[model samples]
Every structure is written in structure tokens, then in C-alpha cells.
Target: MTHVPSAAPFDPQTATIAIVTFNRSNLLTRLLTSIGEMDPKPGRIVIIDNASTDDTAEVVESFRDAVAPADIVYRRMETNTGGSGGFSEGMRVAYELGSEWIWLMDDDVEVLPDGLAKMGKWAPRFKSIQGRRYDYDGSAFYWQYRVAEPLGIPIPFAPAEFDASGYKAMNSGCFEGMFIHRDIVQQIGLPDPRFFIYWDDQMYGWLASRKTSSVIVDEFVLRRTREIKQWDMGIRHMNASSNAYRYYIMRNRAYIKKYYRELGVYRPVPFALGTTLTFGKELIRLVFVERTVRGTSNLFRGLRDGRKIARDASWQPMPPLEAATTTGR
Candidate 1:
């Protein structure tokens, strides 16, 4: 695996915090407040506003000096590009700004006081690192994940995967607290904005692992501040997803297949089995956990759309960062 030379030391002054936010201005304020409390704040922040109709711009202005001397670049989108697009643009802006590390997160999570410091400890060794997180109730979030290579899908969080190393090698990534070195970004390019929501981070991280070992360090760095209904799944709790999100979860598999195909690892049988299992899990979530089947129709619709999307000869995967152009849209 390619290691970033020791000469390129990890420094907060060389890092940029990238946030993708939507209509939740209140949550954005809380997040910015937490960032202001960082002992050593990142050198820059790039806020990608996803065409929020709310007072998101006002909220950002209120914290203009939250981290003084660290410029905050707020770019508003003409349309809501969803989480995938926002993070894509966020990373692009930070990279163009010449940040050595780009830390990406959603606005709903609050950074722990020593989050940056903890992540910094591992930066000298790892090019792609993920920090630990807490759920709304202060329970540890299950994050350790591996990809099911034959199926080209990620296995569910496996807490046991973490051990004495204080970190575990991982092929999957979560955007909420994903700390990535710019070198990995240069190779994998940006997260595919065409994803619009689901599975983008996992694919991006997998690409990073191809260039270097990606890992999740066992250090609590952030806590989810938002509360939502969840069902305990023994190892972890599953949060209820929206109908649109459910559709994306299924439809986005096409992109996953496309990625695996490009890698020459795509398998039809295993992928089919994986898709069936995914559909079954969603059905259980909707019927047993959510106690509603109202969104069941979306599952079929998404599957159909995904197949059509897979056959589209025009669709292409994301290019490397050097070849990518940020539209700022």
C-alpha cells in the first residue's frame, strides 16, 4: 500500500472541514458551535448548501468567525443536489483550496472536543481514516464494515472486527466523519454525485483502499445529535429511512454494479443473491420495524429503474480528481 511520506506531517492548519447541509439550519448552528470548540480547529471550512430554502445562509453567517483566521467558503447550490452531490463539490472545493486533508461530514453530527486531535494522531500513518462516532443516546455506533467482494456489496457493521490494533482495515467508509488525505482523493477522484444519496461513500472508500489501506481508528470523534426512531438489530440499531431514500438504496445498486464491472470483479449470481437479500431486509424493516408497507411499491420501482440505469451506455463512473472539474452547481 502507498503510504504518505512522513515528511508530509499531519497538521490541522493544512486540513479543511467540508460540510454538506440542507434545510436544517438549527442543526447546522449546533455543529458549527461544536467546531468552534475544537482545541485546534482545521485551517478552512467549505459549506456546500444544497439549495436549502431555509435560513441556512444566515446560520452560516452567524458562525463566520467561529474559527477565526480559518476562512469559511460557503457555496450555495442552484438546486438540491442531495448528500452525494454536495460532498462531491465539497471535496472538490477543498482540494482546489490546496488542503492536505479533507474531513467530510453532514450537519446533523457534532464533533467531539478532541475529534480533530484524535484523527490527527493516525494521519501520519494512514491515508484514508474513519473516526468512531456515538449515536444520539450516547451509545457507540457500529461502524466497522467490509465489502462482500463476490456480490460487490458491503457487509453490515461488524463490531468484532475491531481489536487491539485500535483500528481495523476497512473497504467501506461513512461520510459522517470520514477523514481522507488529499492523495487518496487525487487517485479515486470525488464521490460520485450521480449517486445522489446512497452507497457513494462506500465506493469512494473502496477506491481509496486500492491506492492505500483504509481504516477506521477506534477513537470517538463525533456524536450524532439528531434523534430518530430506530429498531435495535442486536449488533446495531437500524434507523428508519424515507421512501425516497429507500428508492435510492435500491436504485443506486446499479452504480455499485457499474463500479465492480470496471474493476473486473462483477459477478451476476452473487449480485443477484445480494439484491434479493437487500430487498428482504427492507421488507422486514418496513413491515416489522416500521409497521407500515406504504413504501413497498417503491422497492419494485427502484429495482426496475436500477436495471434500466445499468443498461444506459451513456452513464460513466467518476473520474480521478485531476481529470474532474467542479461545476459549483
Candidate 2:
């Protein structure tokens, strides 16, 4: 794919917002409404329906003529490609349609009025302060994924002091409210389709850090609509704990290790061992603690499958050719 230069100067009207939705029609409608209320509204809006069996298409169609300042375009995928695939398709469409920036959001995330504006302000600054070849420096970096504990439940991990300088190694961020420059997308290409469901954001952020600088804006906060409930092991526990999560965690981590290795960054053997132990702990938690039969089975299957992929010598890191050149300016 050819890298498209920034068509015109940076204007909110030229920024395209791409939202990927599954079966959450109601939540998607609210998110769309929030986008419509932005002060300097996005130029275009593209909604990719990931073969949702719900009323997602109808909800989008209802707002087609109603959303102001932003022209709405909807693409319905024939099959569910999970979050990674859906967003990849949405972003690709946005780039092809000549968007200067692509605002990627989850179906349930509600964007505050100032959300885009804040990103618009900080994105350029973040990209301008250079570090290494792939290192970006900026304020307001995003937090890794966090689940909301119920009223009585205690949060597990304490909020760690985010070392902005350590972003290259941390590779932590979420796509729920990520604002990405079109040029970066062109150069980085799309999110890994093999990821299919989970860890796509981490992988993309990892790639982004390598190409340019980025930081999470402190004042810019996007509210997550859905709360993380307690882990239930009964209904195919592995889907969440083992199958999807484990496979990507292992496969992608290996991919990252190999990538850095090629860059002449020597990874410690202990780090690899620690990562394996971490996965094993998660597996034990699902089987012994959570005691979910389905989760155990999924973990077993994921390990079996992931191990096979990890051993394959044909695995290769994705090139950064499709990355877009324009930062935010």
C-alpha cells in the first residue's frame, strides 16, 4: 500500500472517526451521540459492524442523516473478526477515504466533548518530541487496561507511577479512546489480524512507540461504560482467561522479543522465564482458584496452539512500511 501524505492542513473537519461495534447497539448509539456533540466535530464518521446479530446496523442507520458536521459511513463485515479485525477494517477504510487522523473507539466508550480537542492539542506535541527511532515523548500517556472492581471488591494492582520515559518497554495503552495520526497508520500498517480479539492495542502501541513518541494526556479521560465483573469459569472460561488472552499474550510477547532482538536489544533469559511463569500462574488461577472447567480447557488449548506457533521459525515481525508520516500537524 502506498503511503498517502497529509492531504491538507490539520483541521478537525479532515479528521475521520472510526468506531467498531459488535452487538452493543444501545451503547453504540450513545457513543455516536457523544461524538455528534463535539465542538469541532470530526469530518467523517465510519462505523464498522462486526456481523452483530443485534440491531447495530439499524441504530447506525437511524443516525445517518442526523449526525451533524460528520458524514456517517457504515460498513458491515460478513463475519465477526473481534475487536482487532473490526478496528483494523475501520481504520483502513478511514485512511483510504482520506482522513487526516483516525479516532479509534470501542462500541461502549463515550467520548466527552473535549476528548477529541485535547487529543488534537497533545498529539502533535507528543509526536514532535523525538526520542529514539521508535521512541515518542509526550504528556498524557494512556494506562494499561484496568477492570473496575465491584463496590466491595478491591482493585488488585496499585496505580504504578507511569514512567513516560519507559514507554518503549512498557508498551501500555488502550484503543478505547486512542487518537492516531493517519501518517502513523500508513507507516505502521493495520493492527495484527492474527490478534483477532485481544492485545491489539498493546501491539499497536508497541509498534507506535518504536516509530514515534507518544504519552497519555492526563486531563483527557474517556469513560468506560461496561464494568468488569468477576470472572466466571462456567461458560467456556478459557475464552477470556486462556484461549484468546493466553494465546495473544504469549504469541505477541514472543513477537516483541524477536523484534527487539533484531534491533540488537538483548532480552534477558529471566524475563522470558518470568513471562512464562506469569502465564502459568494465570492458568493455575483459572483451574484451581476459579475452578472453571471451560476456562481450564481453553487455557490448555491455547497453550497447545500457542506453543506450536512460538516454535515455528517462519514467524516474522511486521514491517512498519504502512505507517503514516504525518504526526498530528
Candidate 3:
């Protein structure tokens, strides 16, 4: 059973903008500029740097005064922890700071002038929420998905437009623009860093949905600045992926399987079939749309590695928040 926290007033001052950035110092500067433009800026901004080889630290130092009034706490990791690990650390830092709300985003997007204010309007209603965004081409960025029960996978769902309620139910979470409450974080703990890159947000959001009605509000809060080749799928857009992403997409299925197993929804045959179907779909996209066989071998390699990981007896999930003292970040 999920415990619904008592309704309390939402304060913008209680929000902490948590960002995970890598080598994209240019993009990070843009995002910081946007945050500086907010009418009432966030109380604090915690940046988790994934040990970028670039001048990311110097760039952040340049923005100390740009986002003034809002305290900026930047921690550079000893090594590149990827997006998953960075987000986990960022959320942990924000949660320990006693932030009532943590707004998680990657450095690639720029929050709108009124982004935090718009998202705050629904904070009292939805504890776990997501905001809409636009692509570099000005098209709506797709971020809608529902969790498939029993199989415990995300199924992309798109609606023509949001109705009068101003939001839609969602289980698929994109760390790119997830606005979540501390109570939800207290329940789900942190995202599993083992994922490394892909599907981490989906699993985290699905876990959050188990505790409350996770939603993506109709408000447009972000605009993506990074441009990548994309295939229009009508209802959704398929962004071209890199070799690293291709490998992780397939290999991360093992972690997904572990999640289903923990929830007692794992069925060997169905899950295997689902994974096969996923592989086949990606394979087709790589051959036809991507028009190259550069990463073909990576797909199979990832699948083989995923099976090995699934069979490993030592692998375990991150413990829930209740098991921790909340003193460590």
C-alpha cells in the first residue's frame, strides 16, 4: 500500500534544481543562464559533474554569479559515472539538503523562464511529475510511456493533446525533466547506478508510480538544444543512437528483468520474448533508418552480456530509503 503524504502548500523556495552534466560545457552554460532568468529562482542548484575532461568546472565557475542568490554546489566525480550514476548522486545530494522537491534534468536542455513556476502549480496534486519539452527543431519532444504490468516494461503511449486536467498519467520517467517530491524519493531511494545509461529513468519512474500517480503535465518547461538525427514515427520520434547507447539499450534488459523479478512479475518465456522483440526492432532501425551496419555486432554482444549479468547470483538491487539513515549522500 502507498502512503499519500498530507497535502501541503508547495513553495518554489523549497525546490532544488539537480543537474547531471558531462563534457557539454556549452550546453551547461545555456541551462545555467536560463535558470538565472527565472522570476523566483530555485533555492539551490546541485550539479553532479561526471568527471568531464573538458573545461566543465571552469564553465561552472563562470556561472557562480550568473545564478546568484541560488547556491551552486558542484561536485566532480572521480570518474565518469555516466548519466545513471550522476543522477543518483545528484538526487542523493539534493535529498540530504532537505529539499522539498528535486527537479532533475540533464545539461542538454534549457528550462523555460517560467518552467519551475509552471511545474510548481501541480506539486500539491501530483508528487511525481514530468514536464513537456521541445526538440531543437521546435517539435514536441515525446516523453510519454506506461508500464506494462507482469512484463514490467515501458510501452510508449502518446495522446493527441492534453485535456482540461492539464496532465496525463505516466510511468515512463525521463530524468531529462523529472520533477519529483522528497517523499517519493524517500520511498524509491535512488536510481540504480548499475543501469549506467539506458532505461534507468523508466524504472525509477515506474517505481515511483507504485507509490503514487506519476504524471506528465501539459506545461512546456524545457527546450532541447542538442540536435540529433531523428525518424518521425508519427506518434513518436526515434532519435538516432550511438554505439554506446545501442549496447546499453540491449544489455540493460538484464537489470529490467531483475526489477520484474523483485516485483514477482518475472515470467521467463514472456520476458525473453519481449527482449527478443525489442532487439529485433532495434536491429531493423539500425539497418534501415540508420543506414549502416557499424553497430550491428554491438547488439549481439550486448544481448550475450545481458544474459550473463542476469544469471549472475551476486547482483542485487539498491536498497529502499527506509533501510538507510539518510545521512549519506
The estimated TM-scores of all candidates read 0.95, 0.74, 0.94
Best TM-score among the predictions, by candidate number: 1
Residue 200 in candidate 1, Cα distance off native in Å: 0.8
Error of 3 at 158 (Å): 3.5
Best-to-worst ranking by lDDT: 1, 3, 2
Q: Predictions ranked by TM-score, top down? A: 1, 3, 2
Put down candidate 2 lDDT per residue, 209-268, tens digits, no spaces. Answer: 556654554444356555433343332122234455655555554444455555566345
lDDT of 3 by residue, 1-329 (tens): 33354378778878899999999999999999999998678888999999998999998998889897888989999999999999999998888888888999999999999998899888888899899999898988886567665555656555647889887888778899999988889887899998999989998998898888888888999999899887788888777888898898899999999888877878988788778777877877786669877887888888889999989898778776653233312
Q: Which 10 residues in a row give candidate 3 its minimum summed lDDT? A: 320-329
- Report how far residue 127 has shifted in candidate 3, in Å: 0.8
Model 1 spans > 4 angstroms off? 1-6, 323-329
Query: Over 4 Å off in model 2, which ranges?
Result: 1-10, 128-142, 145-170, 230-268, 280-294, 321-329
- How far residue 21's Cα lies from its native spot in candidate 1, in Å, is 0.5
Output candidate 2 Cα RMSD.
8.8
lDDT of each: 0.86, 0.61, 0.86
The TM-score measured for candidate 3 stands at: 0.94
